[model samples]
Target: MSNRWCAVVRCFVVGPIGNKFAPLGDPGRQSYEDSLQVFEEVIQAACQQVGIDPVRADQIAVAGEITEQVFRHLFEDDVVIADVSGGNPNVMYELGLRHATGKLTIQIGEFGQLPFDVNTVRTIQFSRSPRGLIDARNQLERALQAGLLDGQDVLTATRIFQESGEGKAEIDLPLPEPSIEVDGSDDEPGFLDNMIEIENQLALMTDNADGVASSIEVIGAVTESVGAELERAAQSGASNSARLALISKYASEISEPVEMLEKSSADFASNMTSINDGVLSVLGVIQNGDPSELPEGWDGFLDQLIGMAESSREGMEGLNTFGTAAEGLGSLSRQLRGPGRKINNSVGNMRKAIAKIDAWERAARSIKHKAANNPVG
Candidate 1:
């Protein structure tokens, strides 16, 4: 993958780029430039956080047309940060290109400046002040670091499209012949070698499982925080529109952490399935073939199996904790949506959030059940 860092935006000016956004700069060019600088600073901070040298369109040499370079970066770069403030037509168009490819893209904009097309999608918002810049940097930095380590491209726009019930991009992968050889030749992997490999895989799965469990705890905490905020709004601002708006913003804020946890948990489950199959295959070989090749105590094979079983047990415990948290969500929902509640107006959005929590709980339970029913060794 190319290490190119890309930022998609237009020239900072008073008027909209392509009749897309309302005219700005009743305050003039400085206002435009100030907002763009906030975008630039956050991008640089995020790049540094993820260990990528920051590069912009003008900073890099290009042998082709400017549009060509822009498209290439959007498609080829590991990450492309887009600024959607003022709904710049060029930036929005390029973001659509990135979305079509379902590539990794980070979006930020000035608060409340985005149009409806991009508004429903998640976008980090920042102000043009020093404190706001620092907050924006920290928030984007955490998100970028997580994406860098996830080992998968985060297709945010694709998710938004699917969630909106729009048509999905069809994905098709052609299958190939099996690459693993089990002919028992010297060229093929021997018993001890395969055992060692499976052992390593088991360890990685266990670590990933731990990460998932920790993330679930974070989910529970964030959910409770949301509950508290809603209660506050109900008590003091049930009739206040501004308070209701603040409540909506806080609900959106938790989506980032929730999304991060969901991604990590899904990856954890996939790894567990692969590791389970691999360990069982190795166990079959050991039981059927010569056991003499293995050293004393089956050369740590049984230990690895036991470790995997213990890890699966821990994963189940985490799921149970998540279920308990889900119960809390149901209780909280009753209070928020039940009869005579002041926050009844906010119940619709809160239910959407609760549904997300419920889905996560079920996923955790399913993974735990699969692990429990399967043989560890």
Candidate 2:
């Protein structure tokens, strides 16, 4: 029986720290601290998952020569995790060495720092958020369970290529699309992880269905209340000035709720409009055709974007209806609108808004086309 056992692990925690001597910089020091914290959390989770001590390969480097110790760990460790957060040259070189070795190697980095070469390979995206860190750790744990416990000896191409006189052959066999395997309950979150969170949020919108109903009821109640007050004012034979006072008094009653709706509508519009920024990012990544596993599954991430886009469309629709309602409520008329509000006032921002929406549509279509043309394994 193969019993789970603790294992010696190595980390590229100090990337590009130096050539002969590890040079120290405040920026590098801060990066090391942050990246190391992330690495520590991930390794700890792996340890707990597979029953390993999660020993750092560089633990002894402090007592002796760092270069000799690091090079040894790079070649010998069963599993190695590299942090390429800043695209440090030393880390990149060491990562290349591990890549050549074809060992059970894992790579991680902060999202924005990865260069094209490194970014193309599968990597776990790191974030500093408490929840983000936890999610990253959970992802690492799942990956550890998948890669380590599977008990398979997959041959790495680099090992084979090095054996032949041909330095690096252009093989005819179609390269299998690289995928990240992970462990979790079947009900596990989608590739993005937050994908499940989005679904949960959409479900919460069902509760807001009740809110929408209550809003309607509130609208009716306010209407009836205002009508009654106006009726009383008319029956009392109040003058125009007095009647204006009466209506204004009732207007104050709905002011808060009206403001709340306005704020919500603005929020919805802003979020709806801003989603394009993320979509454009996806488009950029897809265009680059990086082989790495995305933080979100392409399909799932695209679907979530589609879902949010649809939700935002619906939200905009609702806001339009809300604006109409506000207009009808003569005394209680104040509402929020998107760039369309200023359509007549000026054409410039509205033109920009239309252009942005058009850009989003074009970008989305481009992504769909690219995904269709180049399906990943």
Candidate 3:
């Protein structure tokens, strides 16, 4: 081995001695310890064959917690050497992680001790004799040099060396051009996209609801002020023309604001209902675990929802302006319709929409309560 830095090899010496040695009886412990000593000797001999000291090798590392630490090391290390003699769960898990990370890994075991799954992978098998140990060490070193040192990558090596191999490589075929059909109606947004847009608009309404409600308060105040002025004018025997003119001017001034407020309030309420519905739909999907169980594309759906939520914040600000405008319109409309027609038709529409939204909101709350009591996951 020329002192060239090829790759970092993390050697994890896992077996019954390091993990489940104490579980065995007294006689078993002696046998286990003896086998571990032989394994250690073999590892040292293998390291020596490659002109590396087992104690001073920088690339080599060990792991104890196979579930967490071993997998973590597999990602961090370039190569892994797993001792799979004892059929340890931790060792198997670590090996799986190494294989998953697509890293170069070598398996070693005492003769006749390797598990069937591990035996499928080419591994060095050693006997207890001095000559057998030497032979095993030399074989392992040669295998490592070929697979790990000479850049014969693990994925390629695994595919080639494993008996039950992946099929021969197929030539890449060019994808055919998609057939396009011209349809003028297709340019319009789809139902889902429209729903998404509505959801975005609704989010805006919720964020500015307080501001909108405050504007409503202002409209009420303006209406009360105008009402008081009209009452005083009537008592003072003012001309119908002047009284009507004042009322009309006030109504005109506040009509746009009230209309804007009503529209925003309706939109706000609608958006709130839509948001609840969207959340419920997602929760329902999650609860059933049907959509989540999709083969590979489930993450894309989650990402789409997240993207919609993130982009809706800007739209909410526009809804706030709409609320202020609606408030002004409501103030103006109150003057036109006297005490006989107290409520404006636009306000009535808004109130109905708000009521529908409230029903949805309550239903959504109930759904949340039920979901909390009964979690699917």
Best by TM-score: 2
What is the TM-score ranking, best to worst?
A: 2, 1, 3
Better of 2 and 3 by TM-score: 2
Roughly what TM-score does model 1 have, to 2 decimal places? 0.35
Q: How does each model score on TM-score? A: 0.35, 0.37, 0.35
RMSD to true structure for each model, in Å: 20.3, 24.1, 27.1
lDDT of candidate 3 over 94-128, digit per residue (tens): 67655654556777887887888777677888886
Model 3 misplaced regions, further than 4 Å: 1-9, 18-28, 31-35, 51-67, 152-377
Q: Write the per-residue lDDT of candidate 2 for residues 1-377, one digit (tens) a residue.
A: 12265323333333433222225656656665665576567656655666654435443312334665566456545676776777878788877766655567777777787777776577888677777778877777676667675722534444564566332322121122322123335774333444444445434433433343344346457768877888888998988887677656656655555444444333333443554444454445544554355554555555554444344333333333444455444443232222123211122222223334434443444456556655777
Shift of residue 116 alpha carbon in model 3, Å: 1.3
lDDT of 1 by residue, 101-217 (tens): 555567778776876677766677888677888888888777676655573454666767767645233221121222333456877876566667766765665675566566556
Computed on alpha carbons, the lDDT of every model, listed in order, comes to 0.52, 0.51, 0.51
